[model samples]
Target: MTPPRDVAVVAYARTDHQGPAEGLSEAETLLPVLHEVLDRAGLAPGEADFTCSGSSDYLAGRPFSFTLTLDAVGAWPPIAESHVEMDGAWALYEAWVKILTGRADTALVYAHGKPSAGDPRDVLTRTLDPYYLAPLWPEPASLAALQARALADAGHTAGPDPAADPLAGPPAVADGAAAVVLAAGDAARRMCGRPAWIRGADHRVEPHALGLRDLTDSPSTRLAAERAGAFRAPVDTAELHVPFAAQDVVLRRALRLDDTVTVNPSGAAAGPLMVAGLIRLGEAAARIHRGASDRALAHATSGPCLQHNLVAVLEGDA
Candidate 1:
């Protein structure tokens, strides 16, 4: 297969992520971050060739919630834009593809969530199958606990190993938003002194039926990493979207991360729901841009029990 074009993350900005940021509307929370990333890249609002975002209406409690947040981007110019209901990592995927296609030299990606406004776990139930799982109305905690028990029964040890039990970790909640800028080749080198070039990126999904899945293993995650070329080279750092301890174990195993690779230095487990994945990607890119790591891996997950997974490999100019 042909290799994908090289696209780099030029800049990224995110909100401080208060436990449950009070008094700040979703747009209010994102506006400054929107401006900050562009300013960091020395680009004006609506200056990018394309713009995309990831968020959820279910969390926002209204239809077209994503449209409301466009006010932060100053949509007056009617720029090329798009939105995804999934985590911002997916939105970043869209923007990356656009730049790779040669249709755009630069792009902007962002994702936000006010999950603290409501029961975030309960909100997640909506992603379940309505014919079966939805009726049970099981919260994420219950599902994860079940998965953890399954892992333990299967004799999987939890730790830096891939089979760690996510349910073993403490529960946490946070509210925040994040944005990233993308540029291709020359545009990328010009925007950022040392761009974090996207070496590979891909995502995969598994059967939604929890009964059909081996809760102890994440085949989908491994598949995505393989397709994204994550194992083709050694990674110095990894920013995985591990909300629980087991997930950390599962993803590390799935991606074949060894002891030499650093994992989750930003404490992504405590970040907001819809935005954490993008933050992981952004953080990994930042480390590469700063010469902290020559190669990095970023992973994102969606759906219950890690049903869906995305992986991106980044490398420095060297």
Candidate 2:
């Protein structure tokens, strides 16, 4: 079944993350963004019908880490809230589902990451399969390099730059956070003069075994695009979560993006880990909200070598 209520992104805010952001607490990093998005939509804490977030306790190197971030949102008076271990984009998806279920008319979604706190590559290895991959302790960049090699062997390349090799890019550790506000129908129209309607949204995942899947292609992304109806209408722009240069080739082919679309104008070179993917979705919606495009595609990925993917199609009023 389709969404019960029309949903749109009314406001978005993200930290200016160039690279590593040291000497800042997670709450400090998130507070400004949370306030910015809410203020843009003229909202206050507990104003949104629901609140959700995405982050990794493992990245924080502690258990129940998200609870600490409640300080940033002023979680007193007890508001309905939820969180995901994945990218904030997934939190947004959950919020969208909540709206469709008629459980809420407005929602707040956000995500944050501080990868520079430790060896990011080694930290990421903790998510891999313990039996086969974790024991080997392969760096995240090494796995991307493997994917890049697979693509090259199949005659696919993202750019002529020598850094197109995944290893050349390495795992860029950045620290930051981002947030977005979602409203439904009238609530949306009232909050923002013109909302970025979520025309379609879906996510998919592939087998966990890196060796079992064809690294050159992202079947999960292709399936997500199909499920999200990404091709139903012409796309004017796309914001892709391409941390490493090589993954761009796989995403382009998987989504069938052409030169007609403006890809990642925000440069998306690097950002805080879990936050980057969600920021891509926010950036795409912002483009539509600002009248930069009639329709746009936002993509996010998780797991090693794009094992999981999320696709979103946003459209502005004609």
Candidate 3:
């Protein structure tokens, strides 16, 4: 069977790097970027054929946080929309699927989270299996530490003191929001001056049980990257959602990205958050627009110990 035609990311936007974005509701934090993305795409809110968003109610200390953000979209006439309790990158996947199915020619995707509202480390316990794991209070960091140790023992990582531990180093939590506008073929041409054609995109999930997984290699990420067709096509840059420093190294190996590929020029100063993965997409698109890179790969991760992952390969026209 012939592969589906490529879709394009026409525009993207993100909020200022800030801590705990207090005093503003989720709607408030998301509204400006929503409008900015529309404007960047040269389209109106009502023009999108479909809309999807990613967010977590637990982070907001309340449920249905995404429903309120609908007000920002002015959904009076109603629109095709969906929500994921995952990151915005997953929402981008949903949007891409919508376009691929011939159901929608244009889509708006957004994601937000307030990691500052609660003790992020403590709250991460909810991601664990409630019946068997939650009671143990295995925070996300500790689980990551287990994986790091496993990698170290397997020689996938360095450092003589394998038992010294890695998670005790530092935390990478932050707060932010991000949005992107996508369109297909002619619709994409009308939306932006320079659209980054999405050559391929794919995501994968590993078993929830930590013991059942291999820590030395992220099979899920490798599977997703392979499905994304990035390895088949040349990639000039890779914007990966690596919150922890060590995970960056792990992902590089999993994706088979060499030093020639530009990685995370944003650095720790940018303060990545839940929307970081989506921001990577936006950053790649920006590189295309600026002619800084011709082809790029963007990746996002979800769940504890990188149990879930997504990858998208993007390219530009000369």
Which candidate number would show the highest TM-score if scored against the true structure?
2
Error at 172, model 2, angstroms: 2.7
> What residue runs in model 3 are displaced by over 4 Å at the alpha carbon?
1-3, 158-166, 169-172, 269-273
Q: Considering only N, C-alpha and C atoms within 3 Å, which residue pairs clash in candidate 1?
A: 162-249, 164-246, 165-246, 166-245, 166-246
Candidate 2 off by > 4 Å? 158-160
For this target, which candidate reaches the highest lDDT against the unseen true structure?
2
Model 1 per-residue lDDT tens digits across residues 178-242: 99999998888889999998888899999989989988899988988888888887899999987
**Mind sharing the TM-score for model 3?**
0.92
Error of 3 at 248 (Å): 1.4
Candidate 1 regions with alpha-carbon error over 4 angstroms: 1-3, 160-170
Worst-scoring 10-residue span by lDDT in model 2: 157-166
The estimated TM-scores of all candidates read: 0.95, 0.97, 0.92
- What TM-score does prediction 2 earn? 0.97
Q: What lDDT tens digits, residue by residue, belong to model 2 across residues 1-318?
A: 235579999999999977777788888999999999999999998788899999999988999899989999877788999999988999999999999889999999999898878888889898899999999999878998888888888887555365566767575567899999999999999999779999889999999998799988899999888888898777989899886778888899899988898888877644678888889989988888788888999999898999999999888999
